[model samples]
Target: MKLLLASSLALATVLGGGASAQTPPTRDPAQIQAGTYAVDPGHTQVGWRVSHMGFSNYAGGFSDVSGTLDLQPKTPATSKLSIKIPVASVTTTSDKLTGELKGDQWLDAGKFPEMTFVSTKVTPEGKDKAKVAGNLTLHGVTKPVTLDVTLVGAGVNPLNKKVTVGFEATGTLKRSEFGVKTYVPLIGDDLHLTIAGAFERQD
Candidate 1:
């Protein structure tokens, strides 16, 4: 009887251990579906750098922006993105320079209140890299632009428990093509845009 009881207990313990091992770990839905995400304005940033006077580059940023991203966790290749930036939100350390940038010769924020980008195609380059081809509208003109995007990964925020994903994209645009040719000879025509955005998963 003692031998049988010991054998039964051993079998029960093995079954319990196996059941515990087979149980699946809980995962966040955001990490699983990875569906659509919105840009976390508090954590995302959009910036651009352009030559000022044929000597040095000037950097500025847009403070007000909105965007949405559709991401597929299973197939990231089908992901899409759309963003809009208010031209009036352009800011620089120098007030004079900032005003000049918003004038007719430059961005003409009064006439064109916003600049937008809508993705046409997303081509995967590697494991965490993609080429985002899209139409960029600026200064009342639209042109095709390609952004080289690098996925910076995703994680859960410790404070809010929100799932967040990060990305970095860089592209160059010809200011003249957008009708922003103010100082062609003095300032370089190529404007380099660097975008770093963090998106928070929403219910």
Candidate 2:
């Protein structure tokens, strides 16, 4: 009897652990709580793509991104956001091209070590989307840009029990407007940006 009882307990523990480990985040907007959230840099990414000499679209990305979100789900228009990206963290498949992009002829990471965006207005589009207009500063120039943002998910993280929210935003910009006109027509003047943002609610 003791052996059978022990086996049953062990089996139950294993099944319970497996179930919890497979839990997934919910997409319900009502589950989001109002609070200030800090960006989870480890899971966030910013990607950019541009046409290369009419041959193909070359892509690159920036890592080590950090940001903050003051969320008010009930009054989403009042929400605020800010993001900072290190110009030096930009990466591409080609080491030589990456180095050239960071030099004075391109982004000039040495002179402008950081790029930033601060939200000036937020307009809720539907139940789970919004239009975020902000001032983007890059290469020592600041210009107004807008992003169409969609909620990816929101729920309590199973491992950390922190309230977390995710979003994916898309936008377009002209490099010439920011004063980084290097190889404009050849490298493509219009740039497409995609951002995957993750934020964990602060206590």
**In order, what lDDT does every prediction score?**
0.84, 0.93
Q: For all the candidates, what are their Cα RMSDs to the real structure?
A: 11.1, 3.4
lDDT of 2 by residue, 55-135 (tens): 999999998999899999889999999999999999999999999999999999999999899999999999899999999
Per-residue lDDT value at 64 in model 1 = 63
Model 1: residues >4 Å from true position, as ranges? 1-33
Q: Which runs in model 2 stand beyond 4 Å of their true positions? A: 1-23
> If scored against the real structure, what TM-score would every candidate get?
0.82, 0.91
Enumerate clash totals for all models, in the order shown.
0, 0
CA shift of 164, model 1, Å: 0.9
User: Model 2, residue 111: displacement in angstroms?
Assistant: 0.7
- On a 0 to 100 scale, what is the lDDT of residue 198 in model 2? 95
Per-residue C-alpha lDDT of model 1 across residues 1-203, encoded as one tens digit per residue:
99999999999999888666652422232354467888888877789988878678989998667899998756767889999999999999899999999998899999999999999999988667889999999999999999999877776665577867888999999999899888885788898998898888777
Clashing pairs in 2: none
lDDT of 2: 0.93
